[model samples]
Target: MIQRHEKQIERIHKWKEDHATLLKRIRKIYIWVIWLMLPVAIFFWLFLPLSRNTVMIWFWSYYALWQVWIISRSKTVMWTHVARFFAAGIWLVGPLCAGLLWSIHYLLADGAASIQEPWSAIILGPIVEEIFKLLPLLLFLFVTGKERQLSLTDYALFGFALGTGFQFMEEVLRSWVSSRESLLGMFISLIYDNTKEWGFAELFPGYFIHGDVIAAGHHVWTGFAALGIGFAVHFRQKLGKWIWLVPLFLLSWAIFDHGAYNSHVNLLTSDIIIEFLHFFTGYGHWYKWLFVLSLFLAVYLDYRTLNQEKKALPLLPHETLLEPVTESIELIKSILQSPKQWAATMLFLRERRAYGFAMALKEREKPRQKIYHHVQLAYHLLGISALLLLSFLAVNSIAVENPYYLAGLFDGLSAWWESLSAFEQISIILTTTLVTALLMLATGGGIISAGFTAIGTGLLAKDTLANSEQIASILRDPKSFFKQLQEDAKEMPPQELMMKLFGLGLDFASRRIPGGKEGIEWLSNLQSKSQQFGKKAKMDGDRGGGGREGNEGTGNIPKKTVTSNKGKTIDVTPTANHSTTTSVPNPAKGTPNSSVDILDKKTGEIKTRRFYGPDGRAVRDVDYTNHGNAKTHPEWPHEHIFKWNSDGTFNR
Candidate 1:
């Protein structure tokens, strides 16, 4: 009897498990279906006037591209799909609120504002609209006990939906209250619009405002509210607690953004700057922009809170991606020698930067940065590998006719917008281009300045290279950039040191010499006291090629050696003349040891490249023996370790 009962129970459990699995799959399909039908919503809402040919073709093409993108294997593409729909759904609520606004405006205000009642349309409109929007959000906060997973972008969307609804109602009433002539004008326009449904601007007569404008406003107000709420919620969330009072400031910001927007009709302040901001952040009027900006702020807060929460959690060693750690030196040798430890150090530094920025931005803030961190790097590697594999198959070019369609459509729309007479497009493009050029110049200049430093350091190395490795090693150091200057420093003319370090000997210290700042800072810093530690430029006449026999004489020295983000290799470049032309005796000779940890160059180094590996670590060049000072590690990979060289050999 007992065995029979147990068997029955087991059978029931198995049935339930199977049923649950089936339900999950069904839900997934249902979600996909809803996601796929989004283009219909877009068409229905856009309400633009265009030829059927243009409308249908554009819509179909757009729909297909969106479909392919969402279903793509890339998580970046998939998440974007979800976000767009979320934005759309957010806008749909506008129609309903707009209906309410129409009822209020006509039933209460009767018709256009009288000469003495300008404030009625301005003040009343915002009051009613704001109530509609904020009430729902406040209600959610009150009932949910805590809104933990909510982001600033979500708030922006919510605000947008509220504004949209208000706009719809307001427009309906505006149309209803219109004169017969205007009504006739609208009807005739509708006929024309239906014939040429190109974009989403044809439904103005029957609606409050365009969906784009409406969505933008809603997004702004909500975004603003989110900023305040975000700040309030940040610390509470980090502590794993909740407080209803957190969103009060957010609510106030919404009020201000909306109230101010409604109050202003000024052309310069209201129409231009306000309108510009509204459009920039996806709002109808500039008044709404503060709200969207707020949303961006909220996103920032949300990420900060989440990061803090993550940090507060107790760490365990289970080999995970979300969290990782390197081994410690509790019972082991030195920390620097341990490969596992260095790996962890590099990983932490890389992750902090990537995820740090990831959570800081809202849903649509330039995804490429995050993509680079989480996936694009891998994709690039895969792309290269695939190229190599395809070459073996003798394929010259490959094109996947999937995601490019949407990109092309976007290109067209952007082009059309660019061609428009509106000042909005012109200002945006001009400002963007100027900013981009400036950034490019800054970055390019930074690189060139750095290059000059390396060359100067190499010059300094001319005298410093007791052996060839000093010259060769400089090329491999993180300071390889500065090493360029130091590379031949030891061999440079005495005058070159003044030229490189101070731009002049003791006479010229602070005269803002063109590229002298970099060379001076790097080499001069190398000197602890007042001693100048730079190289005087060595002319061809000052060449020092004392090919002294290396301690471990130059025998079969590998052509080139490449090191990556901490000796790890991402790629290996050819050694062909890349190494220093100089060589010297190894430690086997009397060459004094003068190596320092200056080459531990990579900071927040995420990925590493690989170069050619030669026979087991040989005395590739001279022996470096400078026991320089090391900085204390606050964000170290793990607990530190020590591995003293009992002999000259230790695990590198």
Candidate 2:
């Protein structure tokens, strides 16, 4: 019966795993579906004679459904999924508050509508929008209990969804409230009405003016930034305990970025920059470039926060790609090294887990592999960025040509739009949108192909050489590399011979120079004086008095001082608890030692001692906490060791 119960438990666990995998695949399918059907959404949303509000409502509803589907698959219970849907309803409440604020502002002001437009965009909009966007997040926090339970990525997505919903309604409200003609309609009208001798500048302005905010823009970016700040606050224990200033700093940055984007301050600030561009490139209105730059910064910062969180803890639902790599390395390390070395290495690996142990191992492997990894990262970054930039430049260049080829294309579009019936308009728009997306993709793919060809040729040549004798020179032969690895495992070593060369002359000069020795002596004296002060203070406190000049101690206090290397002095002080504390200097040549010692005063024996090197790293530690006088049994003594970067920062 017990065996049967165990089998049933195993079956349930297996079922859960299968269900999770199925959900992951389903989520991927849903994402792909959304992307593939985006052009369909764009076409219908633009061309259908349905009320703009209705179209927006449908769009939001579809997105909300996707969000609910995601939450359902989050390994949460049915009640949690249902709660998510209720939390999402808070976005509906947001716009109503925004509407109330707008109405109040309109009724209370004597300003013209033109004045109010910029005022609303710059001031009123960000305030109302950010406040309302935060409401759903606050509600999520209140409902979720401890904020630390949810991953930072999850909260970021929550804020993004909230901003998305608000952005949709806000955009619809803009379209509904505006008295001006639709941007696309005006552009089409301009093409037909001014068919003869049209000004390219007039056509350019229409393209810049848009009623709907794209999902990739300010709203989502700001929301992620704001939530990142909140994540830093709530996960301070995991992030960095007592670092309250970090979240406040992030919050300040988010508010400023949102305000700048909404107020079009990027454009305002770029006028001089644009004029400079005009002076050289003969075209300027660099506001879009500024906007894109700001968006990139926000996105990059959010990515950094997510990266830090990923380092601190495993991301939910998906294991880190490095986990398998690390385990594989450990399995290999175990096979290669002696049991003692293997144990030490395992301890070292655990200590450095937060610092990406797998990546570090790859770094220390064959020099060729390190080069390949670096080149791979560089090529990927350059290839993606350059490809996207070139594709967009190609598209935008064609659109904004001096003769206005895009305007001429719109002229043709006007004729087609007029010729088509309502149902036909939807079909044509869908086809055109898909064709445009395909063209852009094809252009990007072509550029990527050219880039990869060049990059591949160089990499292939490098790899060929790396596999042969050429890389031996870079890593200084295999024997030396293996020796270096062996030596690194033994202890926290000093600067390499080449690195020590620079400091060699300096140390020699310090030894020979008159003032250098005097300065060291002066620094040593200063340490002694500080110790004397501390002793006096201790005596005064013990006697319950407050006088710098205390009675001379013959038997009352014990004091001992040892100075070496004409460097910093280490004071070993005795306490009433029969313990002594001391600092040990580095005995290694060309390495300054900074260490402390604790001893059993009565035995005149070392109880515990920690040895630190020139880089201020505790290279070795010995604690006799459980040391026994009986020689019959041995104690398992150990030291927590660390490796250092070239610049003196410890690995973990």
Candidate 3:
């Protein structure tokens, strides 16, 4: 046996040596990867004609793909997957997107009242673009898993990402091909188009609203489509037949929205008599209300989405365990339960300095790369938002200081406005409102960026302070989470303490992942373990030492029944192992009683409490430790634990 043990140790040592050598080789390879990658990244972003916008286009394009990937996730996603998707998305998205731009050109020249690019871009682009953008998702869904539909949120996110990608490509191409002369020439052309048709305004807000509106429409249309598919797949008996109406509805919605937008012809145009025949009661101007209605309806849909997420949140798996886990799902569910309930809980827990749990849960939910990329996006958005806000401030400041340019702009534009003699008053008001809305959206970016920056910084700070390596490891190896839960939730372990730590990061979990109920099983186990461990300590002396006892001669009589032995003591979770030392409490407070009682009222032989050896086996002596620090409260100087080595390190 000794020879066998020696051989095993030798083999293990050899394996360690080999592993160390492998690690050295891996480091050497990393040096080469750095050399290879840096130049590639730089060149791809600089020298290549398309590379200037590559980061914007490819990054966001991949981001769009990632939305699909996450919703359609068969497994965990990683940076490698993101990179792969970027490469593939760019390859496929480029030509198709180019075609969209050309289609907008021809469609607008054919459909518009005047020859204009931006106006035509706005007028014909959206309707045509929606068709192209919706194709990839539709085909992807059909070929892969027809009936495995997405939730409305994911469907919306995916549609938006796709449209954003298309927009990115369009922007890149526009920037690439644009000339100063072209932009200058388009001013008159664009105005002509806008004068002829009002749809230009709808398309002009393409920076954000373009993707948003189309995503709204697609989300509604395709969302309905997916809902139908899901119904047919999952609950066939009731909804399968009803589901068929989705595509028809999709066609109807597109046609109606398109026709409604196309039907607008200003009263000054050649079609005014036809417009008067149709909209004699001012339907041309009233079309603005449709756009407003559409925007609000989209917002309402989003609200419903959030509420649906909330409803599903509480249903997340929790409490079906021996001890409750400290997953963020529970925390978020609690938050969503009611603003007041969560507010009180947050205040209570935060006041107690129990923030580690939230950090832990955040760490457990999001990995480093996801966090890094998200932070990058946030910073980019911050930059854009800040610029917009500053621009507005500048414009306002300029108006107050100079006044001449504002006068000139208002005069010139107002003259153009005055040209619409019959439509002057209503057009001015509508255009002004449109301008105001544009400013608001641009400025709103600042608000969104600030929100993200604040949340990210706070969460990151909490994670750092909380020592997130433990939780990070769990996220890295999800399969190990259950094992960690079991290990952390043992009776003699710091189950509750770990639970508190995990609780701090709950918000992070709330925003990410599905199936809160699945995650809470481990927490339930931890909770159960806490109760057992707490009960064990409470029942050490047969549960009789419920209150303070002053006498030196301890009562030997065992209790007749199990009872609550609640004491005014802070039982800490284990911090370090091996040393049987614990932090002490106030000497003024009564000592905790270690007693045991019979399980039932009808008892057998009297049971006595016994201490165990370091090996957790039978032993006689109950070891006492004395560890203390100068920071200890002066009033409780003598009560502080003082187990220290010669070096002054607290020997646990």
State each model's CA lDDT, in order: 0.31, 0.35, 0.32
- For model 3, residues 1-652, the per-residue Cα lDDT tens digits are 3345546755764464457668556644533443344455455445544344434443443343344433321111222222322222224544564455555445755522222222322223333443444555555444443122233333434444444444444443343333222454466445534321113224312221221122222223323333322222222333433444443344334323322233332212323333343244333232223333433333333222222222111111222111112323334445433222343333322211112222212223333344334334433543453343223221100011101010111213323444444543443343333222221111121211111111222222123223335456766897887775555443211212232344445544443556655555655566556545534433221212211112232322222222211222322221111111112222222123322111111111112222222333322221211112224422210112324345534332
Please give the distance, in angstroms, between residue 619's alpha carbon in candidate 1 and its true position after superposition: 48
* lDDT comparing candidate 1 with the true structure: 0.31
Model 2 bad stretches (over 4 Å): 1-47, 51-93, 111-115, 173-219, 238-255, 265-652
* 1 or 2, greater by lDDT: 2
Ten contiguous residues with the weakest lDDT in model 2: 395-404
Question: What is residue 552's positional error in candidate 3, in angstroms?
Answer: 40
User: Which 10-residue window of candidate 3 scores lowest in summed lDDT?
Assistant: 396-405
lDDT (10s digit) by residue, model 2, range 55-126: 544344334424422321111112222223223433464545545554655587542332234344443444
* Candidate 1 lDDT tens digits, 1-652: 3345546755764464457667556644533443344344334325522212223432332332233222211111112222333223224344444455555555775432221132332333343444445555544434442233344444444434333333332322222222222465466545522121223433211111332333223334443444344344434433432332345434433443443333232122333444554445445344344543444444344333333332221121211112111112110111222222223333322323233233333222333333223223332433443343223222111121111011111212434454545543433343333222221111111211111122222222222222334333544674764766655443332233433444212112222245544544443333322111111211111212211112222222122233321343222221211122122313232222111111212111112221212322222222121122135322211111222255755332
Better of 1 and 3 by TM-score: 3
